[model samples]
Structure formats: C-alpha cells, structure tokens
Target: MSKNRFFACIRSSFFSRLLMGVVAAAITGTACAAGEAWPKEINLGYQKYGPLIILKSTGELEKRLKEHGVTVNWAEFQFGPPMLEALNAGSLDFAVTGETPPVAAQAAKGSPLVYVASEPASPQGEGIVVKADSELKTIADLKGKKVAVAKGSNAHFFLIQALAKAGLTLDDISVAYLAPADARAALERGDVAAWSIWDYFYAAAEIQLGVRALANGEGIVNNYAFYTSRRDFVEQYPALIDVVLDEVRKTDQWVKNNPVEASEKLAAHVSIDAKILEKALRRSNYGPEPLKPEVTAAQQKIADTLLAIKLLPYQINVQDAVWQPKGK
Candidate 1:
C-alpha cells in the first residue's frame, strides 16, 4: 500500500474512536443527572397523628407500592424533629411531619430534604394549657413563668406566636424544653406554669388532667403538616410520590367523612380515650394539598421568625427545598 493511504487509514480510525468516547460520556452524564435507581423498599416515618396512621392501618400504602415491587417499612416517631432526623440520615426515604420541622431540617447544612405535599392548617389541633385554677388566665401572664415546649416542634412555634400576640417575646418567659410526655408530668406536678402541646396529648390533658387552655393556636399559628422525602428519592421516583400522596389524600377524605369511626380507630391504636380522640378529631380538618406558593410563604415566615429569635443558625429559603415534579 502507498504511504499516504496508510497514514490516512490510521487517522480515520483515531477520529472514529474519539467520537464514540464523546457519545458514551454524554449518555453517562445524562443518566447521573436523571438520578439514582429505585430501591426494593422505602421507609416511611409517621407520628401517631394524621392520615399516615390511617394509611398504615389499612395497608393501602403497602398495596400500592407492592404493585411496583417496592416493599414498605414503617417507623413511628413521637414528634416531627426526630422523624426529620431519620429522614436526614437516609434511614427514612419518605415521612410526614409538622411544617416547622421541614424548615428546621432545611436550615441545617447538607440536608437533602424536600417538601412534596402538605395538610391544611388545623390550628385548633394544638395549644398551650394551664391548670384549670392557675392564675395565669392570659398569654401575657406567662411572663417570667416557666413554660414547657418541645424545642423544635410545631408547639414551639405556637408558643412563640401566642407570646408575641400577647406582647411577650420568648425572652419574656423562662423556657423549659421538654417533650410532651415530660412536659405533661411537669404540668401535673406544678413544676411548670403551662405546657404547649398537640393532640391527643393536649386533649387528654384537657379532659383527664383538667388543664384549661391558656391560649390555643386559633389565630396565632397555622399548624400545617408536611410530607417530605430525600431529594434523590423524589427525583428518581416522582410517580411513586404521586401515588403516595393520592393514597393519603384518599385517607384524609375518609376521615373527613367518618369522623366518629376514624377517632375510634385511632384511639384503639394509640390507646387514648375515645372521647378525647373525638374532641381532637372534631376540630381537625383532614385534607392534603400540594406545595403551593402561599404554603411556602407561610413556611418562610416561620423560618424567619426563628432566625429573628436566633434559634436558627442561618437563613433558609423554603422554596429552595420544595420539590418540583418532572415537567411541572
């Protein structure tokens, strides 16, 4: 063969191999951008409240996920903060929590969490309670009093707002950080002036302990619940998230339709008195919604409130942690 022909053939082979390498690199990059693959099982965390308990009792979530070859594992949390911790640790793929917990979780660095859905504000579900005969008849009366509240839960925000409306700041009161169980003990022992809590604990305290509400959420705070997932899980399985939300929405509707039966069922699971459950459930509005602009705004307000009080380390934009489904 001629020298020119030999050199030309070698150059052609080199260019062809380079072109294939470029195409292969592009495909891998696209796949990575798309996200991780689905796992055989997904973990969900829930507190005793809300439609999650109903979903769990009925096995609807398992049935839906099972169709896709994904099994469901459930974990129960006493409050939103710890449930969010599990989510941040990747031990939970999906979970539901009160609104404030998501903001707190997102404010922490390296948290790959995103809010997917939320329940409407049912402010009456939570409140501050004092002994029926306590002289602390108003929120302003809490000044200089030792008040019990969960550090990062919804009740924390409720107490903050109630105090603010009463022209009192968190600084005005001696804050006692306690969980619902311990807080109830303190309240019963007269160790704390009041306890900020959510139901069925709040209901039980009202009926069983004869603790009268000093101030309820009502106009002070909007107690919205949120469903969140790891960012990767949301990106990879948007459809699955939709299915879970749909099922939960259905459960909410069922609760709304059968309030009595719903309360009785939940009372059985949590072993709380049925009458107290009924009182709590009566005041609740069970509806799940997608993350809307107004909801995000309210969440941002809560984050800003915490930041103002120096409770949050840094500012967080709630919209940044919001999950936008594919093609939305």
Candidate 2:
C-alpha cells in the first residue's frame, strides 16, 4: 500500500485500456476496407459478335479494370439464351444479349438477373433465310416444313411474329431447335426449309452460302440487345457498372463511326470474313442507354407472346427485373 505501488498500478491500467482502444480502431478500419474492396476478377459473357467483341479485342475494359486491381474473364456463347443461363447461374457478372433472352431469363424461377442497359433497336440485324434455290418463297411457305431456330433467341421471337403475320402459328411449322451453326448446316443440307438467325451468322450465311432472306426484322421486331447483370452484382457494384456502361457507350460510338474498320478488328478475333461482318455491322445500330418504359412495354409484349405460345413456362413482369440504379 505504498504511494509508488499505487501510482504504478494506475499507470499500468491506463496503458492497457489505451492499447485495447487502438486495437479496436485498427480492426474496425480493416473491416471497412475489406467491405469496400473490389473483386479480384469479374467474368463477362459475350456472344460471337457485337460491341463486346470489339471491346474485348481492344483490351480497353481490361486495361481500365486493371487499374483497380481487377482481372477480366470473357466467356463466349453461341447465342443469348445460353449466355443468360450462365449469367443466372452466377458464372457471369455481366452479359449482353438480344431482348428475348432476358425475357426468358426473367421468367425462370429464382432468376437473379436485372436489365442494366439496352442498345438501340437494329431491326435489320436478324432474319429468316432459305437456300437460294428453295421453293419456299415466303414466310407463309414455311407452313408444315421443318424450320431451324435457336430456342429462346431473338430470332425465335422474330419467327413467331413473322408466322403470325402470315396467318400461321408455331403449330403450322415443324421447329427444329438448333444452335446457329447446326441450323446453318441443316438449312444447307435441305434438312430444314428455313433458318432463323441473327448477324453475323445471318450475314455470313448469305455471303458464304448464298442463302436468300425470306424476311428480316424491319417491321416485325425491334431486335434490341440488352446489357444485363446479376441483381446482386448491380446492387453491390454500381460504380463498376457505370464504368462498364461508359466504355460500352464509347465503343458503340466507335463502331457506328467506323463500320468497316470495326468489322476488320472484330473479324480478326472471330475469324469470319471482314466483308460479312461489315455488311452486318452497317445494318446494325449501337449506343447503350437506360431502359425506357416503352422498351419495357415492348419486352412485356414479347413475354406475353411467348406465354401464349407456351415458349415460357410462366408469365413474368419485365419491369420487376429492371435495375434501378441508386437515386433513380
């Protein structure tokens, strides 16, 4: 109970409390940093052709994301349905697809996808084609004949609308659900009277195989390409999504301004002839923008049509899955 002993005991207690406070502050700071850290890698899904292909080829997105200590991985899909399937499965952080796939994805149970952005409609970018010598001269001629189309693709919706215009339904035709490559082969082999497809495949078929278009999307479909992501990804990484969309906007402008040059660059990555790509590119529109009510309404019409034809298992509200960015 001496004075020195009392003083020493008091100092010891003060130092111990101070040390504890410092440790707590350090732990809190570390936790906050960890919570805000960007992902080490992000997977982007793309189809064979589009602004994404040009973006991937230029390495611009990779370069920008690299500055944030992130890596980019690209997955290529044959068409939109399978791409959106991968997106919903958590494999892709972001993806671009024709409007039909998103409608289909939104209809799937427990789907976590959200429509983030959309490209302007390019009605001429897709079509139904037949061999130049085929006797099927019109969309009505497809009745009772085998028609190849990728299930759940924009081309599928296009075919449906085209058929309705001809006073026919899907029951009137024998549908052979096939990927673009297989469908092309089927058409060439006369196994299918017509093939529903999108460019650059549509363009390739015409130039490479001399197929003639029975009809295009001009007055039938919008053929809008959409940028979509997992709902969680959009909520968690709004800034990153902004970066991605900004780059997409820039690339879209470039493609629109230089169709031939863009086609050549994309051709290098896809190994398709530049001429075919240019033909497709010239007919297509670009520029990614936020979804408008009209666009959502158009999507709803597509959804309703699919439900009527039993293409979708159930009805879905397209607007429910549309992403609302923070503050809007």
Candidate 3:
C-alpha cells in the first residue's frame, strides 16, 4: 500500500457500512456524541492482549477486507474500556475488550455494542500476578499494598474478587488504575506490588519479568475477553460482522491447532520469549459461543460485583449484548 493510502486507511475506514472515524475529542459510541453521523468505512480497533493480535500482525484481515474495498483500519489500544471509549465516540467500528469494560460502557449509556465472539475462560489462569520475589503471596497479602489494573477491564474484576477472597475491600489496597503498559512498567520498576492483566501482556510479564501470579482466578471468576462491535455497525453491516467473527474464529482455530507456530508468532509480535509465549498461549482458552449462558452468568457476576461496588450505575442487560449469526 502506498504511504498516502496507508495513512488514509489508518485515519478512517469502512467495511460495507462499518466506519471508524478518527477524531480529536473523547467519544463513547458508534454515532458521534454530537449525533454527527456514522461513516461508511470500517475501522477495526484492537489491543495487544486479544488473540487477534496474531491475525493483525499477519496482515490477514486487512488483506481480506481490502478485496471488497472495505479499507481496514487497525488501531491498537492498551485495554478494552478505552478502546470502547473510542468506539463509542465513533472513532472505531469494532474492537475486542474484556467482559468488564463493555458492561461499564453499557451502564454509562455509551453502550451500543454487541458481542462478536468470546474466548475460552481459564479460571485461575487469568489473574493478578506479582514478581516471584515479592512478599505478596496471596490475596490477603495485598491489603494496604498497591494493585495495578486497567480501571474497567476483566483484570479489574480479578482485583475485586481477589480482594474479596482476602476478606478485604477495594479501599484496602491502593488501587493504581493504569493501562497495561503503565501497569507493566510500574510492576517492572517495583512501583506497584501486583499487576492484573490478560494474554500477551500477561505472558510478557511472567516471561520477561519472572512475575508469578499471586492468586489464580479459577473459581474466583472466569476473566474472558470479548470481541465486540458498534451496535449500529453490526446492524447495518451484518455480513461484515460475520466476516470479522469469521476472521477471529480462523485466527483462534489456528492457535488451537498450531501452538508452536502461534507461540513463535505471538512472541515475535509481543517481543517476548517463545517459551513464555507458549505458556500464555496455553492459558488462552478459546470458546465457540461468545454469549453462551454460562458466559453470560460469568459476565453477570462481574457486573453484579461492579454494581455492588458502584462501578456501574445499574444492571446492564448482557443478554442483549450478544450478536448471534443471523439464521444460525
């Protein structure tokens, strides 16, 4: 692609009826906050932790979307909540984030989002971790200590559950609300005692920093990530939503069938060790149903926790958030 075309693709894009309008101000839904309008180009927002990082790095979806002149624009974010922030502002058409961010968004009335798909839930696998050398060994040990997490991520839920397990409250620990990059940096510098994270970012810590999870999330809750799209986009370009889901499924299937190759690719993409990538890859549980009832129940648990803590204004209808294939 020419430099001009690439820049244009990055600035804004369309997938049939999907649009990602890059803007300066803060936004939280597909339609501009000012009710400006939705665009025709498709913009794809993603994060480093999402499994599609592999698909992104491989230039797979871009190549596919280009065939239809659907110009694919990829934006990398630190976590789901902020990415959803962008999508809600109409700056992005689609993205993947953890289960918690969308619920928070939904609570904010910034929620015109629907599930594109879901990944495997490995309880105790995704969680709050600490440097093996740290004195924080269990959830109880985190009391009065600083815990790092993206403010509205699934890891945030982990932090909450982990706190409860320790018989403590959010006020017990000094919550250092930071994105993944900042949290990782702080963890590396011993700025914070513990870090809650998911996938590639999660693997990077265990491998590069020798961080060990202090408490696993097994029975605590399933911290699964989600692929979501703007509600307007899903409705207008249902076929494109299918394409996006298909691409994600293909990428996930590839990871399932070829761990070694997938790990190598992920390691290269994240600049982590292949062995560490392999470990994280093993933790990535792929689920076929994005909004399965069990998954919804799990999401509800997180939602309920958030509500109990007043992180949300009211209960969000997670069932309405799922995007099922038409006629499936």
lDDT string, candidate 1, 1-328, tens digits = 8999999999998899999999988887676556433458888999886789878988988888776798989999989899898899899999988778898999878999999988888899998999999998999999999999998999999999999999999989999999889999999999999999997789889899999998789998888889999998888777778888899999989988988998888888878788898888788877777888999999999999999999899999999998888777
Residue 15 shift from truth in candidate 1, angstroms: 17
Model 1: how far is 301 from its true place, Å? Answer: 0.7
The C-alpha lDDT values of all candidates are 0.88, 0.92, 0.77
The residue ranges of model 1 lying beyond 4 angstroms of the native Cα positions read: 1-38
The stretch of ten residues in a row with the least summed lDDT in candidate 3 is: 16-25
Cα lDDT, model 2, residue 149: 97
Candidates ranked by TM-score: 2, 1, 3
Tens-place lDDT digits, model 2, residues 271-304: 9899999999999999999999999999999999
Error in Å for residue 250 of model 2: 0.8
**lDDT, candidate 3, 119-194, per-residue tens:** 7776645768998888877889888998888888888888788788879999998999998889999988999999
The local lDDT score (0 to 100) that residue 225 gets in candidate 3 is 74
Give the CA lDDT, 0 to 100, for residue 188 in model 3: 87
- Provide the lDDT at 302 for model 1: 98
Q: How many clashing pairs does model 1 include?
A: 0
